[model samples]
Target chain A: AQSVTQPDIHITVSEGASLELRCNYSYGATPYLFWYVQSPGQGLQLLLKYFSGDTLVQGIKGFEAEFKRSQSSFNLRKPSVHWSDAAEYFCAVVGAGGTSYGKLTFGQGTILTVHP
Target chain B: EPEVTQTPSHQVTQMGQEVILRCVPISNHLYFYWYRQILGQKVEFLVSFYNNEISEKSEIFDDQFSVERPDGSNFTLKIRSTKLEDSAMYFCATNRQFADTQYFGPGTRLTVL
Candidate 1:
């Protein structure tokens, strides 16, 4: 079984301030990690994904996340957040192998609120 | 990014009524999936379809729920009897291959009253 935990329930940051959202996962095999964002009334958009290679992966809207295998984490980071960046973020992991690979287990989610 | 579209951006149905949600991929895709998010919960996987049959499904995907690629293009999920708990944002997603990044539709907000 695979699961993701997002420690922060909600985070508020002023415009131009740095932001980090924590995400940890439990998986026995190589973790196929992903970050998704959902704005009000919008669908979940893929922010970034990590299958292998670089530990740090960049995503759309200037967001990035680092896959730390040692810590079993893939935390999202942004040097500066814009007011429009306010949205709900989710971290997900796909379990390993077989026909069972398509299901993506998601975190509880973290709501990011950007202030002026 | 892969593209997918879902119909009935919002659907309102009376409890016990049947509701069908549709998903259409821009191009041909072998894998199609359905997921849902309750008001304040994580996005949960419902089921996945491939090669005209279900490849995988979660526990939440019960007997009342069904999926099919009836026309070889439009993939759909049909809930036999709507319950209050079935009210949520149901999303349709598709990917090119196994372990591939899935592209999600804007979703259909199904409200069962």
Candidate 2:
């Protein structure tokens, strides 16, 4: 079985500051990873996803995540945080083969608070 | 841009009552899914539907839970007998193809009183 762990429960950063949210996963093989964001009372929006190729994958809203196989991590990062970026973020992983389609194991999540 | 849409933004139902949450996925999408998030928990996948049938489901989707695409556009999740634990924000998502990018709709908040 695959699982995901997000070490940070909450993080606060000032506007224009750099931000990083850590995520680690346990999977037997190369996995498909994704990052999603959800504002209060809103549906989750996909921030980025990593299937293969480059270790660093860029996504919408100027966000990016690096897939580190050695560490089993896919941490999301943004160079400059905007106030609007404040939201709860989740890291998820899906297994590689059979029975993996649409099966996503999500991390507990990390709430981000951006301040001016 | 085309997007998934869910109905009844908020639903309040008594425990043991039946409730249905509806969604209309993007017209061309071939895969549809239902997920739920408890008030303070991570989102969990409940079930996935493809080719007009269920392709996969989680343990959370038991006999009490069922999904249907009664029409060409509308997909629904029906809870036979709701429990307090079932109270959560239910989301509907669709992907152009299996294992591809998925787009989510505004969730329907179900409150089982």
- For every candidate in turn, the CA RMSD to the true structure comes to 1.1, 1.0
Q: Candidate 2 — which residues are off by over 4 angstroms?
A: none
Q: What is the interface RMSD of candidate 1, in Å?
A: 1.1
Count of steric clashes across candidates, in order: 0, 0
Q: Which stretches of candidate 1 lie over 4 Å from their true place?
A: none
DockQ of each: 0.81, 0.71
At residue B44, what lDDT does model 1 achieve? Answer: 96
Instruction: Write model 1 residue lDDT over B13-111, tens digit each, in one string.
Output: 999999999989758567888999999988999999888889889999999999998888898999999999999999998988887888899999999
Tell me the whole-model lDDT of each prediction, alpha carbons only: 0.92, 0.93
Give the Cα RMSD of candidate 2: 1.0
- What does candidate 2's lDDT look like per residue over B1-113, in tens digits? 88899999999999999999999999999889999999999999999999899999999999999999998899999999999999999999998776777789999999999
Best by lDDT: 2
lDDT of 2 by residue, A1-116 (tens): 88999999999999999999999999888799999999999998999999999999999999999999999999999999999999999999878676777677889999999989
DockQ measured for candidate 1: 0.81
